[model samples]
Target: MKSFAPKFVWFDGRYVRDSEANVSVMTHAIHYGTSVFEGLRGYWNSKNLNIFRLEDHVKRFRNSGKVYSITLRFTDRQISDAITALCRKNNARQSCYIRPFYFVGRYGINLHVTEKSPTHAAIVMFPFGDLFNRNGISAGISSWRRINDSSTPPLAKMGGNYLNSILATQEGKRNGYDEAILLDHLGNISEAPGENIFLVRDGKMITPPSSSSALEGITRSSVIEIARDLGYDTVEREIPRTEIYFSDEVFLTGTAAEITPITSVDGKPVGNGKAGRITQKIRNVYSDIAMGRNKKYSRWITPVY
Candidate 1:
Protein backbone atom coordinates (compact mmCIF):
# COMPACT_ATOMS: atom_id res chain seq x y z
CA MET A 1 0.00 0.00 0.00
CA LYS A 2 2.99 2.30 0.39
CA SER A 3 3.47 2.50 -3.35
CA PHE A 4 -0.13 3.59 -3.88
CA ALA A 5 -0.33 7.22 -4.95
CA PRO A 6 -2.13 9.60 -2.66
CA LYS A 7 -4.97 10.49 -5.01
CA PHE A 8 -8.67 10.92 -5.63
CA VAL A 9 -11.36 8.31 -6.14
CA TRP A 10 -14.81 8.77 -7.69
CA PHE A 11 -17.55 7.33 -5.50
CA ASP A 12 -21.30 7.75 -5.72
CA GLY A 13 -21.05 10.75 -8.05
CA ARG A 14 -18.32 12.43 -6.01
CA TYR A 15 -14.55 12.43 -5.88
CA VAL A 16 -13.00 11.53 -2.52
CA ARG A 17 -9.65 10.56 -1.10
CA ASP A 18 -8.58 6.92 -1.35
CA SER A 19 -8.08 6.73 2.35
CA GLU A 20 -11.26 8.67 3.19
CA ALA A 21 -13.75 6.99 0.90
CA ASN A 22 -16.04 4.63 2.78
CA VAL A 23 -19.08 2.40 2.21
CA SER A 24 -21.52 0.73 4.53
CA VAL A 25 -20.16 -2.49 6.09
CA MET A 26 -23.48 -4.21 5.61
CA THR A 27 -23.66 -3.47 1.88
CA HIS A 28 -25.68 -5.95 -0.14
CA ALA A 29 -23.01 -6.40 -2.76
CA ILE A 30 -20.40 -7.01 -0.08
CA HIS A 31 -22.54 -9.73 1.42
CA TYR A 32 -24.13 -11.23 -1.67
CA GLY A 33 -21.33 -10.53 -4.20
CA THR A 34 -23.79 -8.64 -6.43
CA SER A 35 -21.27 -6.23 -7.94
CA VAL A 36 -19.81 -5.44 -11.35
CA PHE A 37 -16.39 -3.99 -12.13
CA GLU A 38 -13.84 -3.31 -14.84
CA GLY A 39 -10.05 -3.26 -14.92
CA LEU A 40 -8.54 -0.60 -17.23
CA ARG A 41 -4.95 0.43 -17.76
CA GLY A 42 -3.35 3.86 -18.22
CA TYR A 43 0.11 3.75 -19.76
CA TRP A 44 2.90 6.32 -19.60
CA ASN A 45 4.70 7.06 -22.87
CA SER A 46 7.30 9.55 -21.58
CA LYS A 47 5.46 12.25 -23.61
CA ASN A 48 1.71 11.65 -23.59
CA LEU A 49 -0.45 9.29 -21.50
CA ASN A 50 -2.70 6.56 -22.83
CA ILE A 51 -5.60 4.72 -21.28
CA PHE A 52 -5.86 1.59 -23.40
CA ARG A 53 -9.24 1.04 -25.06
CA LEU A 54 -10.94 3.55 -22.82
CA GLU A 55 -14.36 3.65 -24.48
CA ASP A 56 -14.64 -0.07 -25.02
CA HIS A 57 -13.72 -0.80 -21.43
CA VAL A 58 -16.35 1.61 -20.10
CA LYS A 59 -18.98 0.14 -22.42
CA ARG A 60 -18.22 -3.35 -21.14
CA PHE A 61 -18.30 -2.11 -17.58
CA ARG A 62 -21.72 -0.60 -18.18
CA ASN A 63 -22.92 -3.81 -19.77
CA SER A 64 -21.72 -5.86 -16.79
CA GLY A 65 -23.68 -3.62 -14.43
CA LYS A 66 -26.81 -4.04 -16.55
CA VAL A 67 -26.49 -7.83 -16.48
CA TYR A 68 -26.58 -7.76 -12.67
CA SER A 69 -29.54 -5.35 -12.60
CA ILE A 70 -27.48 -2.43 -11.33
CA THR A 71 -28.61 0.73 -13.09
CA LEU A 72 -25.76 2.99 -14.15
CA ARG A 73 -26.87 6.60 -13.86
CA PHE A 74 -24.07 7.70 -16.16
CA THR A 75 -23.53 6.90 -19.80
CA ASP A 76 -20.41 5.18 -21.08
CA ARG A 77 -19.18 8.44 -22.48
CA GLN A 78 -19.81 10.13 -19.15
CA ILE A 79 -18.11 7.31 -17.23
CA SER A 80 -15.17 7.49 -19.59
CA ASP A 81 -14.82 11.19 -18.93
CA ALA A 82 -15.06 10.67 -15.20
CA ILE A 83 -12.41 7.95 -15.37
CA THR A 84 -10.10 10.26 -17.23
CA ALA A 85 -10.66 12.97 -14.65
CA LEU A 86 -9.96 10.57 -11.79
CA CYS A 87 -6.77 9.34 -13.41
CA ARG A 88 -5.56 12.86 -13.95
CA LYS A 89 -6.38 13.76 -10.37
CA ASN A 90 -4.22 10.91 -9.19
CA ASN A 91 -1.39 12.13 -11.41
CA ALA A 92 -1.16 8.51 -12.47
CA ARG A 93 1.25 8.88 -15.37
CA GLN A 94 3.18 5.71 -14.57
CA SER A 95 1.22 2.93 -16.21
CA CYS A 96 -1.63 2.67 -13.74
CA TYR A 97 -4.55 0.27 -13.44
CA ILE A 98 -8.02 1.75 -12.95
CA ARG A 99 -10.87 -0.11 -11.28
CA PRO A 100 -14.51 0.97 -11.12
CA PHE A 101 -17.06 -0.94 -9.06
CA TYR A 102 -20.84 -0.61 -8.82
CA PHE A 103 -22.31 -2.47 -5.86
CA VAL A 104 -25.60 -2.84 -4.01
CA GLY A 105 -25.69 -1.01 -0.71
CA ARG A 106 -27.51 -0.63 2.63
CA TYR A 107 -28.76 -3.26 5.10
CA GLY A 108 -30.80 -5.90 3.31
CA ILE A 109 -30.55 -9.54 4.30
CA ASN A 110 -33.45 -10.72 2.16
CA LEU A 111 -32.47 -8.46 -0.80
CA HIS A 112 -36.07 -7.21 -1.23
CA VAL A 113 -35.54 -5.54 -4.63
CA THR A 114 -35.11 -1.78 -5.16
CA GLU A 115 -37.30 -0.85 -2.21
CA LYS A 116 -34.36 -1.26 0.17
CA SER A 117 -31.63 -1.46 -2.43
CA PRO A 118 -29.23 1.40 -3.02
CA THR A 119 -26.47 1.56 -5.59
CA HIS A 120 -23.04 3.09 -4.93
CA ALA A 121 -20.03 3.44 -7.16
CA ALA A 122 -16.29 3.67 -6.52
CA ILE A 123 -13.35 4.21 -8.85
CA VAL A 124 -9.74 3.57 -7.81
CA MET A 125 -6.51 4.12 -9.70
CA PHE A 126 -3.21 2.61 -8.65
CA PRO A 127 0.21 1.97 -10.07
CA PHE A 128 -0.22 -1.53 -11.43
CA GLY A 129 2.34 -3.94 -12.76
CA ASP A 130 1.60 -7.19 -14.58
CA LEU A 131 -1.41 -8.93 -13.03
CA PHE A 132 -0.13 -12.39 -13.92
CA ASN A 133 2.92 -13.46 -12.00
CA ARG A 134 5.78 -11.58 -13.71
CA ASN A 135 8.15 -14.55 -14.00
CA GLY A 136 6.39 -15.11 -17.36
CA ILE A 137 3.53 -17.17 -15.92
CA SER A 138 3.99 -20.95 -16.24
CA ALA A 139 0.46 -22.42 -16.20
CA GLY A 140 -1.50 -25.66 -15.79
CA ILE A 141 -5.01 -26.94 -16.51
CA SER A 142 -7.21 -26.34 -13.47
CA SER A 143 -9.19 -29.07 -11.74
CA TRP A 144 -11.85 -26.46 -11.06
CA ARG A 145 -14.27 -26.06 -13.95
CA ARG A 146 -15.75 -22.77 -15.00
CA ILE A 147 -19.33 -22.14 -13.88
CA ASN A 148 -22.01 -23.20 -16.33
CA ASP A 149 -23.60 -20.48 -18.47
CA SER A 150 -27.07 -21.75 -17.56
CA SER A 151 -26.27 -21.25 -13.88
CA THR A 152 -24.79 -17.79 -14.45
CA PRO A 153 -24.18 -16.06 -17.73
CA PRO A 154 -20.40 -16.05 -18.32
CA LEU A 155 -20.99 -12.97 -20.45
CA ALA A 156 -21.63 -10.93 -17.32
CA LYS A 157 -18.47 -9.98 -15.33
CA MET A 158 -20.15 -10.22 -11.95
CA GLY A 159 -18.42 -10.65 -8.58
CA GLY A 160 -20.12 -13.89 -7.62
CA ASN A 161 -18.94 -15.56 -10.79
CA TYR A 162 -15.29 -15.20 -9.75
CA LEU A 163 -15.39 -17.83 -7.01
CA ASN A 164 -14.78 -20.50 -9.59
CA SER A 165 -11.96 -18.43 -11.01
CA ILE A 166 -10.57 -17.77 -7.57
CA LEU A 167 -10.41 -21.45 -6.74
CA ALA A 168 -8.76 -22.23 -10.08
CA THR A 169 -6.29 -19.39 -9.69
CA GLN A 170 -5.35 -20.53 -6.20
CA GLU A 171 -4.99 -24.05 -7.45
CA GLY A 172 -2.39 -22.89 -9.94
CA LYS A 173 -0.51 -20.90 -7.31
CA ARG A 174 -0.52 -23.75 -4.84
CA ASN A 175 0.80 -26.12 -7.48
CA GLY A 176 3.67 -23.68 -8.29
CA TYR A 177 2.09 -22.39 -11.47
CA ASP A 178 1.24 -18.77 -12.21
CA GLU A 179 -2.31 -19.23 -13.57
CA ALA A 180 -5.07 -21.74 -14.36
CA ILE A 181 -7.11 -22.61 -17.44
CA LEU A 182 -10.64 -23.67 -16.53
CA LEU A 183 -12.81 -25.88 -18.72
CA ASP A 184 -16.52 -25.30 -19.28
CA HIS A 185 -19.08 -27.77 -18.01
CA LEU A 186 -19.10 -29.54 -21.36
CA GLY A 187 -15.34 -30.15 -20.91
CA ASN A 188 -14.47 -27.59 -23.59
CA ILE A 189 -11.75 -24.96 -23.20
CA SER A 190 -13.10 -21.79 -21.62
CA GLU A 191 -10.44 -19.33 -20.40
CA ALA A 192 -7.98 -18.40 -17.72
CA PRO A 193 -9.58 -17.02 -14.62
CA GLY A 194 -9.18 -13.36 -15.57
CA GLU A 195 -7.68 -13.53 -19.04
CA ASN A 196 -8.89 -14.72 -22.44
CA ILE A 197 -7.09 -17.75 -23.85
CA PHE A 198 -5.71 -18.00 -27.40
CA LEU A 199 -3.82 -20.67 -29.22
CA VAL A 200 -1.55 -20.59 -32.29
CA ARG A 201 -1.34 -23.48 -34.71
CA ASP A 202 0.14 -23.84 -38.20
CA GLY A 203 0.83 -20.07 -38.39
CA LYS A 204 -2.79 -19.17 -37.58
CA MET A 205 -4.43 -17.75 -34.42
CA ILE A 206 -7.54 -19.27 -32.82
CA THR A 207 -9.50 -18.37 -29.71
CA PRO A 208 -12.84 -19.43 -28.33
CA PRO A 209 -15.78 -17.35 -29.50
CA SER A 210 -17.70 -14.99 -27.22
CA SER A 211 -20.16 -17.86 -26.78
CA SER A 212 -17.48 -19.91 -25.04
CA SER A 213 -18.53 -18.69 -21.62
CA ALA A 214 -15.72 -16.14 -21.68
CA LEU A 215 -15.62 -12.56 -20.44
CA GLU A 216 -15.13 -11.02 -23.90
CA GLY A 217 -11.95 -9.20 -22.86
CA ILE A 218 -11.01 -5.79 -24.25
CA THR A 219 -7.33 -6.64 -24.70
CA ARG A 220 -8.31 -9.90 -26.39
CA SER A 221 -10.13 -7.99 -29.14
CA SER A 222 -7.29 -5.45 -29.39
CA VAL A 223 -4.78 -8.21 -29.95
CA ILE A 224 -7.03 -9.82 -32.60
CA GLU A 225 -7.35 -6.57 -34.57
CA ILE A 226 -3.62 -5.97 -34.38
CA ALA A 227 -2.94 -9.54 -35.45
CA ARG A 228 -5.22 -9.18 -38.48
CA ASP A 229 -3.39 -5.96 -39.39
CA LEU A 230 -0.12 -7.82 -39.04
CA GLY A 231 -1.36 -10.16 -41.82
CA TYR A 232 -2.08 -13.21 -39.65
CA ASP A 233 -5.38 -15.07 -39.97
CA THR A 234 -7.35 -14.98 -36.70
CA VAL A 235 -10.10 -17.51 -36.02
CA GLU A 236 -12.82 -17.60 -33.35
CA ARG A 237 -14.91 -20.70 -32.72
CA GLU A 238 -15.53 -23.47 -30.23
CA ILE A 239 -12.04 -24.67 -29.34
CA PRO A 240 -12.08 -28.36 -28.29
CA ARG A 241 -10.54 -29.94 -25.18
CA THR A 242 -7.68 -31.50 -27.14
CA GLU A 243 -7.10 -28.34 -29.22
CA ILE A 244 -4.75 -26.97 -26.57
CA TYR A 245 -2.74 -30.16 -26.24
CA PHE A 246 -1.69 -30.09 -29.89
CA SER A 247 -1.41 -26.30 -30.33
CA ASP A 248 1.99 -24.94 -31.23
CA GLU A 249 1.56 -22.06 -28.83
CA VAL A 250 -0.77 -20.64 -26.16
CA PHE A 251 -1.28 -17.19 -24.66
CA LEU A 252 -3.68 -15.16 -22.53
CA THR A 253 -4.68 -11.52 -23.06
CA GLY A 254 -6.39 -8.99 -20.81
CA THR A 255 -5.92 -5.43 -19.52
CA ALA A 256 -4.16 -6.69 -16.41
CA ALA A 257 -2.49 -9.81 -17.82
CA GLU A 258 -1.64 -7.98 -21.05
CA ILE A 259 -0.18 -10.59 -23.46
CA THR A 260 1.54 -13.51 -21.73
CA PRO A 261 2.94 -16.46 -23.62
CA ILE A 262 2.22 -19.90 -22.26
CA THR A 263 5.11 -22.33 -22.33
CA SER A 264 3.23 -25.46 -21.34
CA VAL A 265 -0.24 -26.87 -20.73
CA ASP A 266 -1.33 -29.87 -18.55
CA GLY A 267 2.39 -30.85 -18.30
CA LYS A 268 3.03 -31.04 -22.07
CA PRO A 269 5.39 -28.76 -24.00
CA VAL A 270 3.60 -26.29 -26.33
CA GLY A 271 5.47 -26.22 -29.66
CA ASN A 272 8.83 -27.41 -28.30
CA GLY A 273 7.99 -25.70 -24.99
CA LYS A 274 8.52 -22.17 -26.20
CA ALA A 275 6.59 -19.06 -27.20
CA GLY A 276 5.49 -19.25 -30.84
CA ARG A 277 6.37 -16.61 -33.44
CA ILE A 278 2.78 -15.40 -33.97
CA THR A 279 2.24 -15.03 -30.23
CA GLN A 280 5.43 -13.00 -29.86
CA LYS A 281 4.45 -10.73 -32.75
CA ILE A 282 1.02 -10.03 -31.34
CA ARG A 283 2.53 -9.31 -27.95
CA ASN A 284 4.97 -6.85 -29.49
CA VAL A 285 2.22 -5.07 -31.45
CA TYR A 286 0.05 -4.74 -28.38
CA SER A 287 2.96 -3.40 -26.33
CA ASP A 288 3.68 -0.80 -29.00
CA ILE A 289 0.07 0.39 -29.22
CA ALA A 290 -0.30 0.57 -25.44
CA MET A 291 3.02 2.43 -25.13
CA GLY A 292 1.84 5.36 -27.31
CA ARG A 293 4.31 4.45 -30.08
CA ASN A 294 1.75 3.56 -32.76
CA LYS A 295 -0.07 6.53 -34.27
CA LYS A 296 -2.24 4.25 -36.39
CA TYR A 297 -3.85 2.98 -33.16
CA SER A 298 -3.78 6.21 -31.17
CA ARG A 299 -7.55 6.28 -30.98
CA TRP A 300 -7.48 3.49 -28.38
CA ILE A 301 -5.86 5.70 -25.76
CA THR A 302 -7.04 8.94 -24.16
CA PRO A 303 -4.09 11.16 -23.24
CA VAL A 304 -4.38 12.11 -19.61
CA TYR A 305 -1.39 14.42 -19.64
Candidate 2:
Protein backbone atom coordinates (compact mmCIF):
# COMPACT_ATOMS: atom_id res chain seq x y z
CA MET A 1 0.00 0.00 0.00
CA LYS A 2 1.30 3.43 -0.95
CA SER A 3 1.40 6.15 1.70
CA PHE A 4 -0.48 9.44 1.21
CA ALA A 5 1.84 12.29 0.23
CA PRO A 6 -0.31 15.27 -0.57
CA LYS A 7 1.36 18.57 -1.38
CA PHE A 8 -0.73 20.58 1.05
CA VAL A 9 -2.87 19.62 4.02
CA TRP A 10 -5.56 21.82 5.50
CA PHE A 11 -4.17 22.05 9.02
CA ASP A 12 -5.51 24.26 11.80
CA GLY A 13 -6.82 27.28 9.86
CA ARG A 14 -4.42 27.21 6.93
CA TYR A 15 -2.99 24.97 4.22
CA VAL A 16 0.48 23.74 5.13
CA ARG A 17 2.98 21.36 3.59
CA ASP A 18 2.65 17.77 4.68
CA SER A 19 6.06 17.95 6.33
CA GLU A 20 5.11 21.04 8.33
CA ALA A 21 1.98 19.49 9.88
CA ASN A 22 2.74 18.10 13.29
CA VAL A 23 1.03 17.36 16.60
CA SER A 24 2.41 17.26 20.11
CA VAL A 25 3.50 13.86 21.39
CA MET A 26 1.36 14.34 24.48
CA THR A 27 -1.71 15.10 22.44
CA HIS A 28 -4.77 13.54 24.11
CA ALA A 29 -5.93 11.95 20.86
CA ILE A 30 -2.52 10.39 20.28
CA HIS A 31 -2.30 8.83 23.72
CA TYR A 32 -5.95 8.35 24.69
CA GLY A 33 -7.51 8.15 21.21
CA THR A 34 -9.82 11.11 21.79
CA SER A 35 -10.60 11.79 18.14
CA VAL A 36 -13.27 11.44 15.42
CA PHE A 37 -12.81 11.24 11.68
CA GLU A 38 -14.48 10.57 8.33
CA GLY A 39 -13.36 9.19 4.94
CA LEU A 40 -14.66 10.42 1.55
CA ARG A 41 -13.85 9.48 -2.03
CA GLY A 42 -13.41 11.90 -4.93
CA TYR A 43 -13.80 10.55 -8.45
CA TRP A 44 -12.30 12.20 -11.50
CA ASN A 45 -14.46 11.73 -14.57
CA SER A 46 -12.91 12.73 -17.89
CA LYS A 47 -12.33 16.46 -17.18
CA ASN A 48 -14.71 16.77 -14.24
CA LEU A 49 -14.09 15.90 -10.58
CA ASN A 50 -16.75 15.34 -7.93
CA ILE A 51 -16.74 14.24 -4.31
CA PHE A 52 -19.20 11.63 -3.19
CA ARG A 53 -21.60 12.80 -0.46
CA LEU A 54 -19.38 15.60 0.80
CA GLU A 55 -22.06 17.24 2.96
CA ASP A 56 -23.19 13.95 4.47
CA HIS A 57 -19.63 13.00 5.32
CA VAL A 58 -18.99 16.38 6.96
CA LYS A 59 -22.21 16.17 8.96
CA ARG A 60 -21.22 12.73 10.21
CA PHE A 61 -17.77 14.01 11.12
CA ARG A 62 -19.37 16.75 13.27
CA ASN A 63 -21.70 14.24 14.88
CA SER A 64 -18.82 11.89 15.62
CA GLY A 65 -16.92 14.77 17.26
CA LYS A 66 -19.93 15.57 19.40
CA VAL A 67 -20.06 11.97 20.66
CA TYR A 68 -16.41 12.16 21.72
CA SER A 69 -16.70 15.70 23.09
CA ILE A 70 -14.09 16.89 20.56
CA THR A 71 -15.86 19.91 19.18
CA LEU A 72 -14.81 21.24 15.78
CA ARG A 73 -14.55 25.04 15.50
CA PHE A 74 -15.77 25.03 11.90
CA THR A 75 -19.29 24.40 10.71
CA ASP A 76 -20.20 21.53 8.38
CA ARG A 77 -20.24 23.71 5.29
CA GLN A 78 -16.92 25.25 6.22
CA ILE A 79 -15.33 21.85 6.64
CA SER A 80 -16.74 20.72 3.31
CA ASP A 81 -15.36 23.81 1.63
CA ALA A 82 -11.96 23.24 3.18
CA ILE A 83 -11.87 19.70 1.83
CA THR A 84 -12.80 20.89 -1.66
CA ALA A 85 -10.20 23.63 -1.58
CA LEU A 86 -7.53 21.22 -0.36
CA CYS A 87 -8.30 18.75 -3.13
CA ARG A 88 -8.12 21.49 -5.73
CA LYS A 89 -4.90 22.78 -4.25
CA ASN A 90 -3.37 19.33 -4.64
CA ASN A 91 -4.52 19.24 -8.27
CA ALA A 92 -6.02 15.81 -7.69
CA ARG A 93 -7.51 15.02 -11.07
CA GLN A 94 -7.82 11.32 -10.42
CA SER A 95 -9.67 9.04 -8.05
CA CYS A 96 -8.63 10.05 -4.56
CA TYR A 97 -9.56 9.56 -0.93
CA ILE A 98 -10.13 12.43 1.52
CA ARG A 99 -9.88 12.11 5.28
CA PRO A 100 -11.21 14.87 7.53
CA PHE A 101 -10.46 14.41 11.21
CA TYR A 102 -10.72 16.37 14.47
CA PHE A 103 -8.71 15.37 17.47
CA VAL A 104 -8.03 16.53 21.06
CA GLY A 105 -4.68 18.31 21.06
CA ARG A 106 -4.47 19.12 24.77
CA TYR A 107 -1.38 17.74 26.49
CA GLY A 108 -2.80 15.84 29.44
CA ILE A 109 -3.47 12.38 30.77
CA ASN A 110 -6.56 13.45 32.67
CA LEU A 111 -9.64 11.54 31.54
CA HIS A 112 -11.95 14.46 32.21
CA VAL A 113 -12.44 16.68 29.15
CA THR A 114 -13.52 20.31 28.97
CA GLU A 115 -14.56 22.83 26.34
CA LYS A 116 -11.13 24.39 26.66
CA SER A 117 -9.48 21.20 25.46
CA PRO A 118 -7.49 21.91 22.34
CA THR A 119 -9.21 20.66 19.21
CA HIS A 120 -7.50 20.41 15.83
CA ALA A 121 -8.93 19.57 12.41
CA ALA A 122 -7.23 18.70 9.11
CA ILE A 123 -8.16 17.50 5.62
CA VAL A 124 -5.82 15.35 3.54
CA MET A 125 -6.48 14.24 -0.01
CA PHE A 126 -4.40 11.89 -2.13
CA PRO A 127 -4.71 9.74 -5.21
CA PHE A 128 -6.14 6.36 -4.23
CA GLY A 129 -7.22 3.19 -5.98
CA ASP A 130 -9.12 0.10 -4.91
CA LEU A 131 -8.30 -0.68 -1.32
CA PHE A 132 -8.91 -4.38 -1.89
CA ASN A 133 -8.18 -6.51 -4.89
CA ARG A 134 -10.92 -6.24 -7.51
CA ASN A 135 -10.93 -9.96 -8.26
CA GLY A 136 -12.44 -10.74 -4.80
CA ILE A 137 -11.28 -11.33 -1.24
CA SER A 138 -11.34 -14.22 1.17
CA ALA A 139 -12.52 -13.78 4.76
CA GLY A 140 -12.38 -15.60 8.05
CA ILE A 141 -14.76 -15.46 11.02
CA SER A 142 -12.59 -13.70 13.57
CA SER A 143 -12.29 -14.94 17.10
CA TRP A 144 -12.45 -11.37 18.34
CA ARG A 145 -15.95 -10.09 19.02
CA ARG A 146 -17.15 -6.60 18.20
CA ILE A 147 -17.16 -4.14 21.09
CA ASN A 148 -20.59 -3.26 22.36
CA ASP A 149 -22.11 0.22 22.68
CA SER A 150 -21.73 0.07 26.45
CA SER A 151 -17.99 -0.25 26.02
CA THR A 152 -17.77 2.41 23.29
CA PRO A 153 -20.21 3.94 20.85
CA PRO A 154 -19.79 1.90 17.63
CA LEU A 155 -21.71 4.44 15.60
CA ALA A 156 -19.12 7.13 16.20
CA LYS A 157 -16.02 7.05 13.95
CA MET A 158 -13.62 7.22 16.89
CA GLY A 159 -9.91 6.47 16.68
CA GLY A 160 -9.87 4.26 19.78
CA ASN A 161 -12.55 1.92 18.47
CA TYR A 162 -10.24 0.91 15.62
CA LEU A 163 -8.04 -0.97 18.06
CA ASN A 164 -10.61 -3.74 17.91
CA SER A 165 -10.47 -3.63 14.12
CA ILE A 166 -6.71 -3.74 14.15
CA LEU A 167 -6.77 -6.90 16.22
CA ALA A 168 -9.33 -8.60 13.98
CA THR A 169 -7.66 -7.58 10.73
CA GLN A 170 -4.26 -8.64 11.99
CA GLU A 171 -5.65 -11.98 12.99
CA GLY A 172 -7.09 -12.46 9.53
CA LYS A 173 -3.88 -11.53 7.76
CA ARG A 174 -1.84 -13.82 10.00
CA ASN A 175 -4.22 -16.67 9.27
CA GLY A 176 -3.99 -16.26 5.46
CA TYR A 177 -7.28 -14.44 4.96
CA ASP A 178 -7.94 -11.21 3.14
CA GLU A 179 -10.40 -9.91 5.75
CA ALA A 180 -12.06 -10.69 9.05
CA ILE A 181 -15.75 -10.72 9.86
CA LEU A 182 -16.31 -9.87 13.50
CA LEU A 183 -19.29 -10.96 15.50
CA ASP A 184 -21.16 -8.93 18.09
CA HIS A 185 -21.04 -9.58 21.82
CA LEU A 186 -23.88 -12.09 21.48
CA GLY A 187 -22.08 -14.06 18.71
CA ASN A 188 -24.12 -12.48 15.92
CA ILE A 189 -22.66 -11.09 12.71
CA SER A 190 -21.67 -7.44 13.15
CA GLU A 191 -19.40 -6.21 10.38
CA ALA A 192 -15.89 -6.31 8.96
CA PRO A 193 -12.91 -4.47 10.33
CA GLY A 194 -13.28 -1.39 8.10
CA GLU A 195 -16.52 -2.00 6.27
CA ASN A 196 -20.11 -3.14 6.62
CA ILE A 197 -21.09 -6.70 5.55
CA PHE A 198 -23.99 -7.58 3.26
CA LEU A 199 -25.24 -10.98 2.17
CA VAL A 200 -27.41 -11.97 -0.76
CA ARG A 201 -29.73 -14.92 -0.42
CA ASP A 202 -32.25 -15.96 -3.04
CA GLY A 203 -31.79 -12.58 -4.76
CA LYS A 204 -32.61 -10.52 -1.63
CA MET A 205 -30.03 -8.33 0.09
CA ILE A 206 -29.69 -8.35 3.88
CA THR A 207 -27.35 -6.71 6.35
CA PRO A 208 -27.07 -6.35 10.09
CA PRO A 209 -29.01 -3.51 11.66
CA SER A 210 -27.45 -0.62 13.57
CA SER A 211 -28.15 -2.46 16.84
CA SER A 212 -25.84 -5.24 15.73
CA SER A 213 -22.70 -3.27 16.60
CA ALA A 214 -22.02 -2.26 13.00
CA LEU A 215 -20.78 1.19 12.13
CA GLU A 216 -23.38 3.16 10.19
CA GLY A 217 -21.36 3.41 6.96
CA ILE A 218 -22.07 6.08 4.38
CA THR A 219 -21.26 3.71 1.52
CA ARG A 220 -23.46 1.13 3.15
CA SER A 221 -26.33 3.61 3.13
CA SER A 222 -25.57 4.44 -0.50
CA VAL A 223 -25.66 0.76 -1.44
CA ILE A 224 -29.07 0.32 0.14
CA GLU A 225 -30.44 3.34 -1.69
CA ILE A 226 -28.90 2.27 -4.97
CA ALA A 227 -30.25 -1.22 -4.55
CA ARG A 228 -33.73 0.15 -4.01
CA ASP A 229 -33.37 2.38 -7.04
CA LEU A 230 -32.42 -0.70 -9.03
CA GLY A 231 -35.58 -2.42 -7.75
CA TYR A 232 -33.81 -4.86 -5.46
CA ASP A 233 -35.36 -5.77 -2.09
CA THR A 234 -33.18 -4.86 0.88
CA VAL A 235 -33.54 -5.78 4.54
CA GLU A 236 -31.82 -4.82 7.78
CA ARG A 237 -31.99 -7.39 10.57
CA GLU A 238 -29.92 -9.57 12.83
CA ILE A 239 -27.79 -11.98 10.75
CA PRO A 240 -26.37 -15.11 12.22
CA ARG A 241 -22.86 -16.34 11.45
CA THR A 242 -24.13 -19.56 9.92
CA GLU A 243 -26.18 -17.56 7.44
CA ILE A 244 -23.03 -16.39 5.68
CA TYR A 245 -21.90 -19.92 4.98
CA PHE A 246 -25.14 -20.68 3.16
CA SER A 247 -25.63 -17.34 1.48
CA ASP A 248 -25.43 -17.09 -2.27
CA GLU A 249 -23.24 -14.00 -2.17
CA VAL A 250 -21.38 -11.92 0.41
CA PHE A 251 -19.81 -8.49 0.03
CA LEU A 252 -18.52 -5.56 2.10
CA THR A 253 -19.25 -1.84 1.71
CA GLY A 254 -17.48 1.29 2.94
CA THR A 255 -15.67 4.39 1.71
CA ALA A 256 -12.51 2.33 1.41
CA ALA A 257 -13.79 -1.12 0.57
CA GLU A 258 -16.36 0.18 -1.91
CA ILE A 259 -18.28 -2.96 -2.97
CA THR A 260 -15.82 -5.84 -2.59
CA PRO A 261 -17.13 -9.33 -2.96
CA ILE A 262 -16.31 -12.01 -0.44
CA THR A 263 -16.07 -15.27 -2.30
CA SER A 264 -15.60 -17.54 0.68
CA VAL A 265 -15.98 -17.56 4.43
CA ASP A 266 -13.94 -19.79 6.76
CA GLY A 267 -12.79 -21.81 3.71
CA LYS A 268 -16.30 -22.41 2.42
CA PRO A 269 -17.16 -21.06 -1.00
CA VAL A 270 -20.11 -18.69 -1.21
CA GLY A 271 -22.46 -20.20 -3.77
CA ASN A 272 -20.27 -20.66 -6.86
CA GLY A 273 -17.47 -18.62 -5.28
CA LYS A 274 -17.69 -15.69 -7.67
CA ALA A 275 -19.23 -12.26 -7.49
CA GLY A 276 -22.98 -12.71 -7.74
CA ARG A 277 -25.04 -11.05 -10.45
CA ILE A 278 -26.79 -8.70 -8.08
CA THR A 279 -23.54 -7.67 -6.40
CA GLN A 280 -21.95 -6.87 -9.78
CA LYS A 281 -24.94 -4.82 -10.87
CA ILE A 282 -24.94 -2.82 -7.65
CA ARG A 283 -21.18 -2.30 -7.95
CA ASN A 284 -21.45 -0.99 -11.49
CA VAL A 285 -24.28 1.37 -10.58
CA TYR A 286 -22.36 2.62 -7.54
CA SER A 287 -19.22 3.20 -9.63
CA ASP A 288 -21.21 5.09 -12.21
CA ILE A 289 -22.86 7.27 -9.61
CA ALA A 290 -19.64 7.96 -7.72
CA MET A 291 -17.81 8.89 -10.93
CA GLY A 292 -20.59 11.28 -11.98
CA ARG A 293 -21.67 9.05 -14.87
CA ASN A 294 -25.25 8.64 -13.69
CA LYS A 295 -27.40 11.73 -14.05
CA LYS A 296 -30.22 10.26 -12.00
CA TYR A 297 -27.97 10.17 -8.90
CA SER A 298 -26.03 13.35 -9.66
CA ARG A 299 -27.65 15.02 -6.65
CA TRP A 300 -25.61 12.69 -4.45
CA ILE A 301 -22.35 14.21 -5.73
CA THR A 302 -20.68 17.53 -4.97
CA PRO A 303 -18.50 18.74 -7.82
CA VAL A 304 -15.13 20.07 -6.77
CA TYR A 305 -14.34 22.05 -9.93
Backbone atom clashes (below 3 Å) for every candidate: 0, 0
> In model 2, how large is the Cα lDDT of residue 170?
98
TM of each candidate vs. truth: 0.94, 0.97
Candidates in order: C-alpha RMSD to true structure: 2.1, 1.8
- Reference-based lDDT, each prediction: 0.82, 0.90
| Local distance difference test, candidate 1 | 0.82
How good is model 1 by TM-score?
0.94
Compose the digit string of candidate 1's lDDT tens values, residues 104-145.
Answer: 887569565452357777788888777754325578888888
| Clashes, model 2 | 0
Off by over 4 Å in 2: 1-5
Top-scoring candidate (lDDT): 2
